[model samples]
Target: MSFPCSDQSIRPRKMQSASLPGVMEAVRCWCGDVCKVKEVTDFSDWLGMKFFMCANYESDPPESISTYVRPPSPPPLCMYYRWIDTEMPDWAVTEIRERGRRAWASLDLEERREKAEAEEKAEQKK
Candidate 1:
């Protein structure tokens, strides 16, 4: 299931290109690298919109690094991209906002539950 944009407690993930439709073709970036389509989950009016971004584009990583099995991918070669879809409708924006709110609320509850359980376990150990 897709999570909300506001709830960043979980890591963001990339949807496989195989599931993408209508964007079939060899779309290349200005840097001559193949571009990948990523969906907008920022919980804004643009939510669910797809865009073609450079495959080499690496967004800013989190400040803390939990583990590093291997070196991360290279940085963005060229900041070139194009939006696949146009402006979203009012109804679509409203729907996306509501969905995002619900998603974050559910995730918040789950996180609180997990934290409480962990605290209880620690108390028991003590």
Candidate 2:
């Protein structure tokens, strides 16, 4: 199926029925703090998935986020989580996995190129 903004496979975000269309509805965590709506942008099958996350939640430090922001994350308060959208279809899952594979491979190539360039610079400095 197709959507006006994105593919049907794209994760949907929960929002207030009465509020603005794009405004996300507030979801409180176990601690009564409003949870943050986050999207999985990493190279994985779950990419583009939207979920509610506790502000104090942490999976593995900086690596948990695709483009991690550095500010010394606070201790996790709770592990509350809820998916906003339904699970993807089999074809959608396969497509996402393939995209993720290509993305990872591209990143590896870029890293290798940068490393080689750095080595060249070091040799020139010697």
Candidate 3:
């Protein structure tokens, strides 16, 4: 699935991240904010899909978020939405997926550590 782009002027800008060597930098939204990658893990079909959204969508004033869902409302969010898992170039998508996997692994490790600590505390109380 692809998000609607109302503004043709704003295009996706490729960027590079030094910390995430394999993953490419996030694309910039029409509103000039960097796009954020949202991980999809809800369904089997959409699992592992990383979609990009305007980083400013949830701003205090609710700026730049796409209103396309409701036409006749207002200008759609900044023209900066794409599926990195599918739309991105092959090489870039591969790197991005790898990065996502690594992130998930880190999170899993942290959760395990927390669980272990909680178990140890419970045992000490007994």
lDDT winner among the candidates? 1
Clashes of 1: 0
What lDDT tens digits, residue by residue, belong to model 2 across residues 1-126?
121121224333322122111555767778788877666555455555566666666544344555446666566677666666455446558877787899999999999999999999999999
Ranking by lDDT: 1, 2, 3
Off by over 4 Å in 1: 1-19, 23-26, 63-75, 89-94, 97-126
List runs of model 2 lying over 4 Å from the truth. Answer: 1-24, 62-75, 88-126
Tens-digit lDDT string for candidate 1 (1-126): 121222223323433342244645646777798877776665565656666666776654555754485466765567655666567646668887788899999999999999999999999999
Angstrom error of the Cα, residue 33, model 2: value is 0.4
- The regions of model 3 sitting more than 4 angstroms off are 1-10, 13-87
For candidate 3, write residues 34-63 as lDDT tens digits: 777765433234444565667755422234
Return whichever of 2 and 3 wins on TM-score: 2
Model 2: how far residue 120 lies from native, Å: 34
Q: What's the lDDT of the predicted structure labeled candidate 3?
A: 0.57
